[model samples]
Target: MNYIYQDILIENGDVVLDAGRNPVLIQDSAVIAQDIKHAIIESGLSVALIGEKSRDGRADLKKQIELLVEEETRLVPGTVTLEEPTLGNIWIFAKTREFGDLQFEVKEVTN
Candidate 1:
């Protein structure tokens, strides 16, 4: 059986509304991306508490994110990567079943 996921669209911490002032609904791959985005954003525990300055902390954070994404969404295992381009910002790259690739940036978590 196939499943179709649906959710309200959100951007930059705000719900996206259509011209009629109703929340915009997204389906399928877009919903998957949104779910991934929420998982990353809501995993708000400080990396410092997890030892962010050390290699172990970074690895731990990556593994934690991978687990959270898999737990929260229908994304296939091993398809998510958490990258830090600069300090305090994580870039999440993932692939959905139908969508080729999805990327999200999580910014400014206190280190």
Candidate 2:
């Protein structure tokens, strides 16, 4: 069986628009990437107080993200690491049954 996923593309919290002002579409890895990114953002907001200052905190956040993504999307999560804690940079690695390996980053902005 062939499985293909597709959705309207969104960028920077806004729906991407073309020259004709039509919503752009994305499929496969792009769709999955957005899904994972949304999951991470939601997880971060849900656990706003959880800082990645300690190993346990990082692990907890990672687990939370994994659970969220797994429950929300088709991607199977791999390793979630805080590549740069100062800037709130998080790296996520996951894969879908149809789309091999996937990697992306989510950055948390603080005031």
Write down the RMSD of candidate 2 (Cα, Å): 3.7
Kindly list the per-residue Cα lDDT of model 2 for residues 13-70, writing each as its tens digit: 7799999999998888888888777767765642452454677766676666656666
* Clashes per candidate (backbone, < 3 Å): 0, 0
Q: Candidate 2 versus the native: TM-score?
A: 0.69
The alpha-carbon deviation from the true structure for residue 41 of candidate 1, after best TM-score superposition, in angstroms, is 2.5
Give the per-residue lDDT digits (tens) of candidate 1, residues 1-111.
354777899886889999999999887777877767666667663244235677877777777876777674466667878777777667777777666787777654442
- Where does the lowest 10-residue lDDT sum fall in candidate 1? 43-52
Which stretches of model 2 miss by more than 4 angstroms? 1-3, 45-55, 76-86, 109-111
Q: Residue 66 lDDT in model 2?
A: 59
Best by TM-score: 2
- RMSD for all candidates, in order, please: 4.1, 3.7
- Superposed Cα deviation of residue 94, candidate 2 (Å): 1.4
